[model samples]
Structure formats: C-alpha cells, structure tokens
Target: MHNSSQPRTDAPSAASEPVIEVRGLAKEYRVFDKPEGLMASVTGLFNRKSRVVEALRGVDLRVEKGEFVAMLGPNGAGKTTFLKLLSGIITPTRGSATVLGSVPWERTDDFRRRFALVMGQRNQLWWDLPAAESFRLHKEIYRIDTPRFERTRDELVDLLDVRKLLLRPVRDLSLGERMKLELVAALLHEPEVLFLDEPTIGLDVVAQHALHRFLAHVQAERQMTVILTTHYMKDVAALCKRLVVVTQGSILYDGSLEQIVDRFTSHKIVTLDLDAPPDRAAIDRLGFPCEIRGPQVILRIDRTRIADVLPGILRGQGVRDVSVEDVPLEEIVAEMFRSGSTAGTDGATGAPR
Candidate 1:
C-alpha cells in the first residue's frame, strides 16, 4: 500500500489564485415519468408527468492549481453531476463556477484547451479506429504543434507503458488497456485541470495500481489540479491527501482522509487472542458485540468505552493477547451512506447518525 501520509515532495506549490472555484453550485433535471402500458404511454405523450431531481445542491469548493483532491460518495450521490458542471459538459441550473478564471459553462476555446474530463464508462475515442489514429485526431482538434504533440504523446504513452497497444483498435484492446489509452489521450494536450469520474472503475487490481502510480507521477510532474470521484477507498488512500464526500446532493465532509476517519468512525475493533475458548455469556456481559473464532475473539467497541473496557477484558479468564484497530474505511463510508446524515467537522463525535 502507498504511504498516503507522506506529501508529494516534487509537486509544485499551488498558485496564489485558485484554479477552480464555485459558490452555491447546483443542478436539477426534469425527469419525465414513463408509462408502462401502450395506452398509458400514448396518454402520457399528450399529458406527461415530470418531477425535478436535484443532482447537486449548494456546493461550494475552491481548488488550488496544484492540488489533487478526491471526491467520494455512493451511487446517485451527484458526484458525476458535480464533475460535469466543472468540466462545462453540462450547465448548472443555479449558482456559478469558474475554472481557470473563466466561467466553465461559457465553453470558450481557451478554457476548453486548459482542462480534460475523463469518464470511465464513456469513450471519447472512436471504437473502430486505432488509438494511434485517435491521437492524431486529438492533435489536429487541439491544434497542437506537431513536435510538441509528439513529445507529449510519447511521454504519456511511455509513462503509462501503452506504446505497444497504440496500434490496436480501441474496440480490440482490453478494458484496462483502453483506460490507459484514455488517460494518454486526455493528457496529450497537458491540461492543467483534470476532472476524473471513476477512471479506475471496473479495472482489475493490477490495472488500478498501474493507473494510480501513473496519475501520481503525472500530477506531481505537471502540477495539475485534479478532482477524482471514485467509490474505491484504495484510490482515495493511494492518490489524494484531501477528501471531499458528497451524498444526497450536498457536501457531507470535506477534510483530510485521516480527519474523515477520526471524525466519523465511532468504534474500533479489538481483537483478543485467548488461551482457550471463552464463555459466551461472560463475553456477552461485557456489553460489546463480539465474534469468537476458535481461540480469538473480535469485539467492536465504541471509541469512548475502550479505556473503560480494556482493563476488564485483559483480566478475563483466558486473556493472553489483545490489539485494537479502527474500523475499516470502507465500513465507515458505508455506514455514512446508510445513515444519510450531515456530518460537521467541528468535533470528533460528529459521526453520521
């Protein structure tokens, strides 16, 4: 696992001015209700019912020029909507945002040239063409000078180790290979700001790690500001120092990864290796949930009660070894999603209800 605690020493310092900024940013879609039967569908064509779905609400964020921030949330949490708004692919229904000193929705050519958006589920490259051909097309569309374009393309291809796959049609390559090419294509112009919506989704572990290393290296080398939305905790842990969690179309937590764990998790897992199988009733009397696995007992103890409960557990009949650990980050995030509560960063007890 990557040591996420260590900051990237080679990364350039952030510029004095923010590369991206937003205030009260929100988006809503009028989703028309579909009728099931033919007659009902015909009736609905004349009198359709519709409801508003808020994809983002009152979101405010500022990202410096060299920052790599991860956006995390469950499905239908508006993460993708947020990215589209930032990338100018979709206009917001309300509020305002600026990327690289220009309003993103304005879609100016200059602004378009300064950023890239990569969605894992979507393909920007032509399916029937070789990736090499697509690269050439990108060069023309971006009006990149021949020499500079070659230099950037070669460097990106080498970094991602996808040179051999360049001649293969995008439809012929594996998902992982296609994704690597996608990254290369997205970076051929060397965009200063990158918007990635689950770029590693559906990738195998090896591919995920490869992309992680490649992204970390590129972000550091170019000092690009990146906003990545992913459900994978490993992605957040391996790549980003800052984490912003969104759910129910609102910002729930915005802080360091360590801070999220410290603030939102209320319990720790305590494992006990005993001399022998312990009495179930006696363990139950301890007032914490425990699972007995042969000679080992695992207990989920509230953080506040650990100090009070440890001494008694250690003094138990067969107590021999004990260790305490925080609950897994995946579980913590899962609980947050299940609870659907707004979390404040003011205190340690600010866990979602």
Candidate 2:
C-alpha cells in the first residue's frame, strides 16, 4: 500500500480507458519431479526432471469501472493464479495485462495503491496485535493523510460495527470478526480496484450476509471496480451481475448471471410442495425428470414441456405451494463445464432447449 498526491504519472493509458485489460495472459509453473532412488537423487543435481503446469492459458478479458464481476471455477482451475497475476504477486509466463493502465507486474507505488486484494485463506492483520495497530500501519504504509485516515477508519469500523474490536487483538477475535477487520484493513486505502478471492469461505450464513451487505454498500457508494473469484452462489447472486466461468485454465463462459442459465441449461425447475405426501407412482407415470423430497416434487422440465407438464403435475397432486425458477446458476455452471460449448463473451450459444 503506497499513495501519492499525484498517482499513475507513468500510466500507459488514460482514466477513461478500461480499468483492467488482459490480452493472452498466461502463467505456467515449472514443477520439479522428485525420485526416490539414491542414484537418481545423486544425478538430480546434474539433471533434474520437471514438468510445466499451465495455470492460466491465453485468457483475454476486460473490466470496466464500477462493475462487479464474479470469476467462477473449480479447484485447480487457475482462479487463484489469475488473481495473483493481476495483483502482481507473480509474473505471467506469457502475454500481458494492464491494470489501471499500468502493467501489474511492474509493482509501482502508484499501481499498488490503486488496487486491494482480499484472500480468505490469508490474514493481513498482525495476529497478536490489536487490529487498530494494523490499521495504523496501513495508514502509514499508504501515507494516508491523518484526518482522512481517521475519517476513513471510523467510517469502516462503524460500517462493520466493530469499533470496540479495533483495540482488541486480532487473534482474540472470532473468525467472522477477523474477517471484518481484514475488510476494513484492505479498504482503508480506498483502492479503485478490489479483488476478492473467496472472501466468504468459512463464514456462517449470518456473517456472510453481513459481509455481503457491506461489500454491496462499498461498491455502490464508491463505484469501485471489483473482480471476485468465489464458489458461493449466494455471493454471486447478491453481488455480481456478470460472470466469467473457467475450467482447466480456460475461460468457458463470460456473460450475465441470467444468460448463464439460458445458455447452459435446457430445462427449468418447478417445485411443487404438496399438502400431503403424494404417491410416487403418480409422478413416475408422468415419465418426466422429477425428484421427490418429502412432500415436494421437483421437476426438471424442458422449456417446451412447461405449459403441458405443469397442468399434469398439478392435476392430481395435493399442491399446497408451487414455485418456478430458472435452473439454479450453480447447476447451469456445472453443466457448462461438463459440456464445453458456447458461453463466451460474445454470447456463445449452447444447445437449444
């Protein structure tokens, strides 16, 4: 965290340019192969065996200011690697990326100050020291003006309702409290771009909800650009309007949260909650894809069958409540990964309904 009265003097582009521009960005790691034999170990000094692991391959993307985009992927899909490259933690093996018009790997004072990254698995605060001490270190590191620092700190602490916890040791706080403090610490600089990597990882539902609310408020109030990688669909539904789904270090889909369902899933789910448990044979006779969970019968009906199937589903059932929804985003995304079809930035169309 570094700051200046005049920032980005060496920026290759103007403020009007995209907040982030990535072209053919890629990262690869040389992993050493170890052998058990003493003879092999003796020769390893002269000739070591290694294999290249491609963490990211030719990923092209652009992000505009004030947009909250979610990056979705499975384990080892390079989601973490992409964040590391963009945040300048590691150099890309090939291609290039410009963040706020400056190459991120440059690690310039101006460039570093403009972005903040929050990783759920890592802790930036001093474990033994009071959170306020860490907050002061941030102020000093960023060279934040005194009055401005105090104002910003107060605003953040108040927003998170952790004013009292600031003086408490970070290790003394619960996981949720520590996360709140981490958010405050990352945001004290008021970065223009925020990178969140599974920020809600281990939190219970209530804590996740609070953090989400705070994030939404901060993004809206400041119009800061945000790129987040998360597995929690709740976070996506609450924060992101756009999504970029990746698998095997390649982007599979990039579009609206809504379009993902339409593009990947050919069917919709209609849930029928019955007054009493219905006979399983009645549903089985329909010969439609359905599930029985207690008194509720969940149907996965093709789009064309909704009109015809809904009536038959409701005809003999003791329907107490009924609801219809597009296939869940999680299901659609999993499907997209399973079938590598169209789901790109240009609206890559998938199978027809």
lDDT of 1 by residue, 65-134 (tens): 7889998888988899999998888999988889999999899999999999999999989899999999
- Candidate 1 stretches with Cα past 4 Å from truth are 1-15, 305-308, 315-321, 341-353
lDDT by residue for model 2 over 1-353, one digit each (tens)?
00111111111233566888888888899999988899999999889999999787777777888889888877787899999999999999998889999999999999999899999989999999999999999999998999999999999899999999988999899889999999999999999999999999999999999999999999999999999999888999999887887766777667777766766677888899998777888888878788999998998888777988787777774798899889877777777665433332334423333
Residue 94 deviation, candidate 2, in Å? 1.1
Candidate 2 residue 127 C-alpha distance from true site, Å:
2.2
Report the alpha-carbon TM-score of model 1 versus the true structure. 0.89
Indicate which candidate wins on lDDT.
1
Question: Model 2, stretches more than 4 Å misplaced?
Answer: 1-16, 35-47, 274-281, 340-353
Error of 1 at 204 (Å): 0.8
Q: After superposition, how far is residue 44 of candidate 1 from its true place, in Å?
A: 0.9
